[model samples]
Target chain A: MSVILPGDDLGISTDQIETSIGPGIYKVPGIKDTKLIPINGGLLNIQRNKQGTRQAAHLESNSRRYIPQVSDMVIGTIVGVYAEYYKVLLQNFLSNVTLSVMAFPNATKKNRPNLRQGQCVYARVSSYIPDLETELECFDLSTGKDGGFGLLDESGYIFDVELNYARELLFNPGFLVLEKLSTKCMFEIAIGINGKIWLKCGDGVPIPGKSTDEDSDKMDVDYVKDLKTTLAAANYIKQCQKVSPEQFDKVLAASFKGL
Target chain B: MSSLEVHAGVLGNSDGSCLYVVNGNKVITSVVGPIEAKARQELPQTVSLEVVVRPVTGLSNSREKLLEEKIRNLLQNIIIGFKYPRQTIQVVVQFLIADGRPEYTALELNMAINSAFYALVDAGVAMYKSFVSTVVAVPPEQGSSLIFDPSMEQIVASKSHHVVTYSVEHDECKIILLESNGLFEMKELKNILDAAKIQCLTVHEDVQRDVIESKLQQDYIWKS
Candidate 1:
């Protein structure tokens, strides 16, 4: 696909009756038929649904700021804790979003899930109103259940990537970036389209908890390994964004050197 | 022939930034926007633009303010603001070096507009069209033709200088702004704008397209 700059007429005319436009596309509203124009410089992606009647078009660009969009799964840091809700920050220097205590599954007034500042949560943007605080929830509203959306592993390390790369890591099933890392070490990762990622390897960072001296000494060795692997894995994943797939193996080796 | 160099995504913290140098003029611009807007900066139905132009030396004065206003007006026409309602896109331009006469601002404005274009595209701000600007100098000599992108020496010899801006969409260039100073006729002005149209289109094709293509290549290295 050729890169489409802003204001370039997308060669693909929107002749279809039903076309859903996505990011980086500006639609002229109140018109009889749809007229789509690219407002950002990026690769223009157009895909038809299986039925062939519906079409989806969007421009994919690498941008730093993450705008809150409904249904987008994001990893955010809890920055503000309140009685009724928690304020989460997806990216620095942007407006904060709210995660209500009751939005979590099985959360009650007295039994609300406890989350503190500096903690991370994996949640979906539940609703968005222009000029107002965005709302996030940790439960699947359609199914009325938790869909792996809640407080992330506290022992996990969180890092940032370009927004587009994070999307590819999460949505593209064919992408082997994660699979390659799995070969190096066992890890559990949550990829947020907002560019923040939570990754944990094995038992995660070593937390000093109460344990017998004999048990702690043996556990300490494994704990150190996990921490190193986690750091290396994060570095490898981050480097993947800069290099092509063929270079992934090389980057992985460099990241895990001496580990 | 004058020299031009463009480097995009140079600033680590900004959403998008470009360091553009043309001839001896150097300008660095950072575009950050559709982001959290302050109370006064917010607009009801469209995104707000905050353009700040800093001079090469000394504190910002009316000269910088005028350039800022001109940039804001030019951006107001090209940017598709409704897409980012209640948000603001901030464009900050700083001039590191200038080769033109201090009294003649045609070159400074031209450099700033082109630099801002690259910065905005780098930031990924939605816009209706891509644009470029060029300075044309009408020499005082009886048989001299309009000079495209005049140098300091040429400006010193010219009777009049004009800054022409064009918004390009679909390979077509439409005049956006024309700022003229000194004595020049409507006939010479017509030819100046006509030549500027060609200059703008060439800049968009040879300069803007090439830079964006290279940047896109790096951005989507995995795809290839």
Candidate 2:
């Protein structure tokens, strides 16, 4: 991989290998011919696949804005309610997307889910055009179910991550940090393409075996213990972001030992 | 050549930031957005860019506003704003130490331009090219004499000055921005411009080396 600044030409003379341009790469007219130039500052990576060798420039830092695309699943906060649609602010996107009331599963004029302001929803982009309002749907057409979409009950912690990191977490479900953490605790996690993650831990309250005078006391103690564990797990997940992939499992194990 | 000290990602809250020090002058630049744009300021075909320059001493006035406008125009040429339409990119530059030469404001502006470019790169903003800016001082009486990256005394003695920014495309240097003041003959102006271009090329090489070194350092950390 070569480090390339903007306007640095990729001197590829041969056309023997199929050349594909990826993000940050642009084709500009040269004196003799068109040359491939990087339009951003980043490291240049040449990847070889069945199709052929393709060049891409990857930036070290992530952009603040996220561009919406069709079929992209995103986590958004409901910002407004209207007669026909709900206004949602998706993470990293400046424009607000609208989720039609009819898009919800079994939604009707009278039987609609009362989505209020400040409520979070996980939905998919049904239609999107640049400079136009994006349309979102809660029900997955193929499954005909919520498919992890719809209004989120306020039971989880929401946090922002780098867009690239969120994509990695989604595609690499077996990522070491997530794999190790899942072994120690049960968690419900939603990874949004726009770099938002919603996570919640299962209620671990222990049930009292028999009716005793100290049953209430035991229940209170158990509740506190469960809450502590849940909070700790969430913190651990957040800290795992700083650890390199190679050291992730080791660091996770060390943290658990300390706990 | 003056020594350059660059510290990237210096601000925790900014999307990307850098502290650039050249000689005794220091400038800090922070980049924020592709973010929400005000309705009035929003552009439909391209992202809006806002550059704010804060001087070391007093509040920003008309002079600072002019500098901000120049920096913003230069950046607009480099950044691929059309890639992020309906958004805004804001660059805030604070001069920590001014060189104390009013006539050499061109040099300060050049430094601010270079610093802002680095901050934008650090923020991962899409740009067409990376540019370097240099200022050349040409004596008023003696048209033959030209000084590159002049000191305050040299600038004060010189009659005219020029600040030129250049970016490399296909290994060829191209001038992107030019600002000149004071009286000078055409031939003398050409001489100063040529010298400034060379200086900018050298600056570009130095910046590229710094970027590569930082990337290598990051890779080392991950590998280790």
Candidate 3:
């Protein structure tokens, strides 16, 4: 499919009874409701509901900067600890979002979750009003449960990738980058829509204080190798998206060599 | 037509970056935004743009500021700023090479506008329509043909020069900005605008489309 640039006629009209627009598209504010145009440059996607009563259209685009969107899952690092919320940085140099102390799974003012500064948390953007500060929650709004949203362990290694690549890794079923990677080494990854990937390969980064015996020296060396291999793994995952899938085997082999 | 060339999404640090070379002018532009806006510059319901134009050797003065102001006027109209409230989109335009004299700004202005278009598209910023700009020079002699993207010598030799920009939407063009200098008659102004519009469309169809296509291809390389 050819990529669509801004101002190109989408050919899809907004005359439908009910049309729900997604990202990369916006109603030209201050204009009549008859026009719907794509604001971003990317592939145009228009879909119909099961009954065909409603239509949806969105543009699929990629960028380094991540704009907070409602319901977007993001991994952020706590930069400041506040009384009511925790200031988090999703990407460097962008605005900081707030994760409320009570946003955790079942908490009250008296029983607040005590999160400190410099901690990483995987949370969902609960509110994203452009005029107001963005808010994040650590629980699923449907069930009021953690729902895999909370502070992440320190053992995981986090790296950044393009937002589109992260979306592909999360949504595209045919992509085998992860599966091919699994055969070489075992790993766990948490992907955020904000172009961040938290990956843990092997035992993850080595903790130096875990061992206290004679084997401590050897264990430290082993963890160091794990760190090296982990670095190699991260580098491979970030770059493999550039080359076609057929050469993944050769590229992966080269990356892991001498580790 | 000095063989227009464009390289988009080349910078890693900025959100979007492009390098555009055409008609003896080379410009590099970077777009960083839909980001947080400072308190003083913030707007309640519109995204404010901060444009910076830096010259080749030294600091930028009034010459760059005027270009920045003109570009801002055009971009504010084309960009869907209301979609990004209380935010800022900053564009930094650096002229790497200028074939014209330091006193003349018509060529630099055209290059800046065109390069900014690519950078914004590369950054994924929302724009209502794509815009392309060109400079036209009318010679001092009568009945002489107009020059498309006139070189420094051509611009100085001509009696009048005009920079015209058109917003290309749905395969149609609309005049969005017109900056003219020197002397020209009303009839010649009409001719300059018509020629500039056609030139803008040609640039968009031939150079801009292919550059964006290659950018998308590189972005989605894993798919194939």
Measure candidate 3: CA RMSD. Answer: 2.1
Q: Tell me each candidate's i-RMS in Å.
A: 1.7, 3.2, 1.3
Q: Least accurate stretch of 10 residues (summed lDDT) in model 3 chain B?
A: B95-104
Q: After superposition, how far is residue B215 of candidate 2 from its true place, in Å?
A: 5.3
Models 1 onward score TM values of 0.95, 0.84, 0.95
DockQ winner between candidates 1 and 2: 1
Report the TM-score of chain B alone for all candidates.
0.96, 0.91, 0.96
Per-residue error (Å), model 3, residue A196: 0.7
A50-92: candidate 2 lDDT, tens digit per residue: 7655433333434445767788888999998999999999954
Task: Tell how far residue A90 is off in model 3, in angstroms.
Answer: 1.1
Ranking by TM-score: 3, 1, 2
Instruction: Kindly report the docking quality category of candidate 1.
Output: medium
Model 3 misplaced regions, further than 4 Å: A208-218
Candidate 2 per-residue lDDT, tens place, B73-173, comes to 88888888877788898999999987755545786797788888778876778788878887788865643667777776667777887888888765678
- The global Cα lDDT (0 to 1) of model 1 is 0.87
Q: lDDT score, residue A171, model 1?
A: 90
Q: Write the per-residue lDDT of candidate 1 for residues B95-210, one digit (tens) a residue.
A: 99987356878898998898888888888887898998999888898887788887888887889989999998898788888899989779878888888898888888888889
